[model samples]
Target: MDVFEHIQSAKGPSLFLLPEWQNRCHLLTAGFTGRSGGVSESPYTSLNMGLHVGDMDETVIKNRQLVSDALDWPFEAWTCAEQVHGNRVQRVTEEERGSGRETLANVIKGCDAIITNVPNVLLVSYYADCVPLYFYDPVHHAIALAHAGWKGTVQQIAQETILAMAEAYGSRPQELVAAIGPSIGICCYEVDGPVIGQVTLLLEKLGCSDDSADTMLELSDNGRANLNLKEINRQIMIKAGILPIHIELTQWCTGCRRDLFYSHRMEGGSTGRMASWIGIRER
Candidate 1:
């Protein structure tokens, strides 16, 4: 069964929600946005949530505001970071709430992962084929969002986020719930020599056997390989102590389902980005 449930309402943002999480924790709202329901021109189409993607800042802000309204979350609480595809995790607090809600200038700097125990601070990160990693530690009342491209995945950003939550909020990795959101899957994410080399090194370090590594990276005769980023990140989560049963993996491949998502690789790089958001509301 698909973990990310698509809620297609005439009145709300086109969102793929983690319904299990919402049902488990009523105050929590966690999900990824689709490519509709807002105002933006061609290429960006409608509903582009990223401020850094060269879309009119005002237009992007309006789109974000629309989604916020749909989520019943205040646009003021929508906090974000400037993703650099690195492993750095920033711990968001009350003082830093709403850091990049309106503009990129105030966004948390140089981090791909943002974690917070602060209520009502909605953590968001943009995506256009890159994976969105969601983490929640109900025991600590904490949550996190990590932007994992192949670079961040190679750098083990998933592990970094886990460790950061453990250190900052005393979250036990075994007790944390995780979800791997929509992204370019192996069916469309083909990589060449340089990327293959980096992935090979990481797989070796993970002690993945040749057969298991082949499942993650299927090489072709032309020296390109289809990379399973979602699975790699899932394995990384397991390696970091998250139980297999606690992790949710989505089947929506952005590349395969461009009608429902934005694919930078498929659409030639000049495209808008969807958002992955997680927040714990204040009661």
Candidate 2:
């Protein structure tokens, strides 16, 4: 079964929702945004959620409003960070709610992952082809969002986010329900040089068997390789103590579904970004 369900209306933004998590907890809303039904122009086309991507501030804000409206969430609760593709995890509190919603003035800086137990704060991270990792510590009412590119992945951002949650909210890894959101898949993501080297080191550190390592990273004779980031992150999650059964991995690849998602790799570097958001409303 596809863990993320695609929902679209003729007059609304296209969204991929995590229905299982929402049904498991009515107050929770978790999903990824798509590239249609908004107001940005050309390359961006419409529904560009990233302000840092050269889209007009007003246009991106309007697009964001459309998403929040569709989700029935107040735009005021939309909190985000300035992602540096590092493994730093910021602990969001009520005080940080709404940071970087409209402008970059107060965006949580220097962090690629944000975790919080603060209800009503919608934690969001932007992505085009890079992976979006979600962590829900149901037992502690804490949630986290991480942006993992090859750099962050090799740095073990998933494990870092899990440890951050445990330290901040006493979240047990076994009780953490996680989701790996849409991004480029191995079929569409090819890398070489330092990327392959870094990933090779990471697989070695993860203690992957030869067959498993080859599956996560298929090396070609030409010194290039196809990387399965989603699977690598899932293995990192399990290595960090999260149970395999509790994680939901999505099959949606932004690189392959250009009509539904904006792919930086496929789009010649100028593209919009989608958002991965997870929030729990106040009870």
Candidate 3:
């Protein structure tokens, strides 16, 4: 749960590497550079991997290569979506690899979530403010990655991934270990009237008491309220049958920690993206 600071290098922007991922199997780690880690001059900083963003294509390519070299994993190992913000889940295979800088139209079908049973095929989804959910099933030898924005959260994208694993790879929710990666936490994720109402409806449908959900959230001095996105997603996981003990959450908020991660809410669309990826190497 420690936040690692960025270490500048003359060659390129280096990410604060995680010790857990060096040789660990069935492990998840991503506390890398924020918008500032890389060779990009301004706006995109140095490590922006988002192709759709307005950053120069060559700069994005250089940044992606930097991230791949820093992690010591092949750039082709990661797969991402155009991210339509839906409930669809796509299965990843060895054939889908090799996109050092693949165009969006080439790889992005109609999927928001990705799962893989093949070793070394990492499933990745980009984020500036949206929550990324990572899952691993040691028993079934499977993995799933999901992007859960408010709409996707309400649709329970995490639950859908678990269900997909069960159907495709015989993975059970109870056996699946999950981690809700860094994103815009409730402390910084303010919503308008309709958005709150949407969340309220989902919360109620999930059997959360109306009184409790409403009461637990209170306005700050300036009238801003903190809503725990991790907690709510955790509730969805449990209701879908995952045990509480198998879940992990980070208190890091993308908006709050702008120096370590990107935040769309914090930087009004002129921002780079932070990516979370997970893969199981072959035995």
The best candidate in terms of lDDT = 2
Please list the residue runs of candidate 3 whose C-alpha ends up more than 4 Å from where it truly belongs after superposition: 2-33, 210-226
Query: Local error of candidate 1 at 73, Å?
Result: 0.8
Residue-level lDDT tens digits of model 1 in 1-283: 5899988688666899999999999999999999988898988988899888889999999999999999999999999999999999999999999899898889999999999999999999999999999999999999999999999999999999999999999999999999999999999999999999999999998889999999999999999999999999999999999999999999999999989999999999988999999999887
Which sections of candidate 2 miss by over 4 Å? none
Query: Where does the lowest 10-residue lDDT sum fall in candidate 1?
Result: 5-14
A best-first ranking of the candidates according to their lDDT comes to: 2, 1, 3
Better structure of 1 and 3 per TM-score: 1
Instruction: State the lDDT of candidate 3 residue by residue for 1-283, as single tens digits.
Output: 4333345566655554333433345354443445665766667675787878888877877777777776666877766776888889887767776432456766657777888888776566788888888787878778887888888887888889999999999998998877777788877877766666677777888888866675434445654566667778888898999999877766668888887677888888888887767766677
Question: Which residue runs of candidate 1 sit more than 4 Å off their true CA positions?
Answer: none
What is the TM-score (0 to 1) of candidate 3? Answer: 0.87
Which of 1 and 3 is the better model by lDDT?
1
Candidate 3 structure lDDT:
0.73
Residue 88 alpha-carbon offset, candidate 1, angstroms: 0.4
Query: Which 10 consecutive positions of candidate 3 have the poorest summed lDDT?
Result: 17-26
Backbone clashes in model 3, listed as residue pairs: 38-46, 39-46, 40-46
Estimate the TM-score of every prediction. Answer: 0.99, 0.99, 0.87
